[model samples]
Target chain A: MKNRYDIVVVGAGPGGSMAAKVAAMGGLDVLLVEKRQEIGSPIRCAEGVSKKGLKKFLPQIKKEWISCEVEGARIYSPDGTMVEMAEEMAGSEVGYVLERKIFDRDLATLSGDAGADVYAKTNVTDLVLKDGVVKGVKGKHLGRSFEVECNLVIGADGTESKIGRMGGIDTTLKPIDIESGVEYIMTDIEVNDLCNFYLGNDIAPGGYAWMFPKGDNMANIGLAVLGKYLIKKNVKRPIDYLNKFVKEHYKDGKIVSVVFGGIPVSRPIKTISNGIMLVGDAARFTDPITGGGILKAMESGIMAGETAIDAIEAEDFSENELKKYEDKWRPTIGMKNERNYLIKEFFINLSDEKLNDLARSINEVKIKEMSVTGLIAMLIEKNPKTLENLSEILLKYL
Target chain B: MIYVDRYKCGYCGTCVAVCPEAAIDLLETFIDINDNMCKACDICVKICPIGALVDEE
Candidate 1:
C-alpha cells in the first residue's frame, strides 16, 4: 500500500465512507481507515433514517439495506396515553428502518469502488503535525505500525473522537450535552408497522425511549438519558432503565443483540482548522431533538469531500480555505442543530404533568394536519403561560 | 478480575459493547462483572472513556 495519499478519512462510518467516496470520485487519492476489524460490527445506532434523507445522498438504495418500512410513529406519554401521527404528518420524513450493518458495509464498498483505498483494523494513534498543520496520521494496521501522509485529514470518528482532539480541537462535552444511550435488538414479540417513542421523566429521565420495529417480530429498543440527569438521580447506567422498559413492555421478547454508545446533543463545535476537518459525531452533528445522525453525517461528509477537492485544486489548504466547509454546512444543518439543542433543553426540563398535558392536547387536536412547527405552536398556544419559554425558542422556526 | 470504579463510571456502556464475553452488566447502581464469564481480555480497560475499569492483579 502507498504510504501517502492526498486525503485520509478516519473512521468507516457513514460520514467517513461518504467523504472518501466523493473525494475518490473527484479523482483524488483518498484513504479511508477504520479501527474495527469489520466496518459495521458492534453497531452503535438505533438504525433508523428517513427515506427522503437516504435518497438525498444515495439515490439508488437497495432493498436489502432496508429492514422495514414504517408508515407512522406512536408517541406515548407518561400516563400511557398515545398519539399516533403519520410519517407525512410528522414532517421529518422518517419512513424506514435500516439494517445499519449492511448499510455501513455497502457504503465502504462504494468508496472502494470509487477508487479510495479502504483499510480496516487500522487504529490511528496520533496525528502527524508540522508547524501546527495536520500533515498525516500514524497508526497501527493489523498489529504493525504504519504511517500515511496526506494533505488533509477528515475526522469522522464518532462521539468519542480521538482524531478531533489530536488535531487540537477540544471535543469534550459537559454532562448535560451528552446522552448516554443503551439499546437491545430483540425478537419473538409482535409489533405494529410504526415506530414508538415513550416520553416522560419517570420513563427516561431527560431523554426518550424508543422502539423501532425491524420486522413483524423484531425491534431495536433503546433509550438515551441525559448524563447530567443520570448523575443527579444517582442512576448508574441507562441499561437499568432499558431493562425495566423491556420487562414491562415486552416480557416475551428474546434478546438477540446489544448496543451501547453516547450521542452528542450539543451544538456543533468549531470543527475546522488548517488541513483538518471534523464531520459526523466528531463534529457533534447529531439532531438534538431526535438523536438521529445518519442523515446529517452523510450530508456533512459529502460537503467535506467536495470542499477537500476544491482546496486541493486551489493549492490553498490553509485554515481560511477549509472554512468553506463550515460556511456551507453551518447555514443548513448547523443552524437546525442549534435550534434543536434549545428545544431539547426546554423539553428535558418539563415535568411529567406538563408532558401529559402536551400529549392530551395533541390527542385532542388534528395531528394528521399539523407540521412539527404547527404542533409546537399548538402546545405554546394552549399553555401560553407555562410554555412561554418554549415559545421564545420556537419563534424562528415557527 | 475487572475492578470498576463506581464513582468514575459514566455508564455509557462501552465496556459492555466491546466485551466479547458479555461479562459486564450495568445494574441500577453499578456495573457488575461476572468473574466466571470474564476472560480478563483487558478490552474493557482500554475502551473505558473515564478510566473506570481496571485490571486487578
Candidate 2:
C-alpha cells in the first residue's frame, strides 16, 4: 500500500511471484501485482514442469501442487511405433503434471511469507518514468487509476505482455514462431501413467500431440503446431485438427474441460532493456519445440530477482546492469530454443512421405533402447548419409 | 458468423460442466470443442458464462 518500494513486480504468475519472493527474502521492500483477482485463474499453459529444474530452487517438494508424477515418457511414431526410455535414464529432469492454480497461489503465498506485499486485481496501465528510466507503474485498481514508485520494475506479464511491448522492446514473433494450441481434459479413460507424445502431420504439423495423465481415468490431451504449419495446411484454427483426433481416437471418454491458447515458439528476447527486465512467457522463454515453459519461467524468475536485488542494493538500476540476467538464462534455455528452431524447420519442411519415412527410420532405432548418446548413434547408423545434413542442421549445438 | 473470443473463454468446465454426453473438457487454460462429438445441443450455449461460444444455425 505504500507509494514506493525497493522492487515492484508486474504479473503474479510463476515468474513474477518468484522474483518477488526472492527479492523479499533478500530483505528488500517488494510489491507483486496481478491483473486477475486470482493469481492462477484463467490459466494459459500446458502445466508441465520438470522435477530436475525445480529441485534447485524450492529444495523440498510440495505435494499439493502436483497432480501426477510422470515417471518416463513415451514417443509414438506416425505409425504408432512406441519408443520409451526407463525413468532413471531419461536424464535428470523427468517432470510432473501440476495443478497450476495451486502451484501459482503457493508461489504468491511464498512471496507474502518472505515479506513481499501482494496485490491482486490491480491492472497496470502504463509505466512511470523518471529521468528516462522506469521508476514505477500506473494502473487502475477498483476503478481508480493510481501510480506507485520503485527502484526497479520486472515484467513477467506473459507472451503478449503489454509492459514489455510498452517498454519499447520489439517482442514480435514470426508466424512460424507462434504455436496455436488446443487441449481437452477427459475422464473415464485407460492410459499408462507416463506422459505420451504423438507425432505426425495429420495430428499436428511442426509439432506433436501430448496426452498427460493427471490421475486415474483422467488426462490432458492437447496439440501445438506452428502458425505456418496451420496456414500451409489451410486449417483455420489448431482446435479443428485436435478435435478431429479426439473423435477418431478417444471414442469412449467424456471430456471434462477444454483449453485453447498460443505458445511463443521462439527464443527469449535479446535485450529486455537496462532498467526493465522481462521474464517467463512475456520474454518468450518457452521451449520452441516442446512449448513447455514452467522450468524456464522459474529459472528466469530466479535470475531476474537476484539481478533486481543486486541493482537495487547497488543503487544503480541501469539496463546495462540488468542485461546480466538475460545473459545467464539465454545461454541455456536460449540455446535449446535455437536447436528447437532448427528441428522445427526441418520437421515442417518435410513432405508427408518423408515424415512417414522418418518415423520408420526412427522405429528402426527403437530410441528407447538407447541412451541419449545411443539414440544419436542409432540415428547415425540408419541414416549414414544424413550425417552431413544433421551436422549442418545441428552446427549451432556444437 | 460463429466464432470464439479467445480472451474471454477460460476453459472453466461449465459448458463441458453441463453437457449430457460428456462433450466438453477443461484442458489447460482454455477449451476444446469436439465438433464431431457435439450434437449441436443448446446446452453449451446456455451454460457458457462469457458468451464465448455461439450456435451457428
Q: Pick the TM-score winner.
A: 1
Interface quality of candidate 1 as DockQ:
0.09
The residue-by-residue lDDT of candidate 1 on A1-398, one tens digit each, is: 58889999998999999999999999999999988788877688898887877898989989989999887778899998788777454345457799988999999999999999999988787889999887788988888998888889999988767666677777766667777788889999888878899998877877899999999899999898776665443344577788889999999999998777778888778888889889998888999888999989999999999999999999788889999999989899888898889988888888898889888876765555323455677777778898888888888754
> Candidate 2 on A60-87: residue-level lDDT in tens?
7789888887866777767776767545
**Candidate 1, residue A282: CA error in Å?**
0.8
DockQ of each: 0.09, 0.05
Q: Candidate 2 A-chain TM?
A: 0.92
Q: How high is the lDDT of residue A314 in model 1?
A: 97
Of candidate 2 chain A, the 10-residue stretch with the lowest lDDT total is: A364-373
Residue A166 CA error for candidate 1 (Å)?
A: 0.4
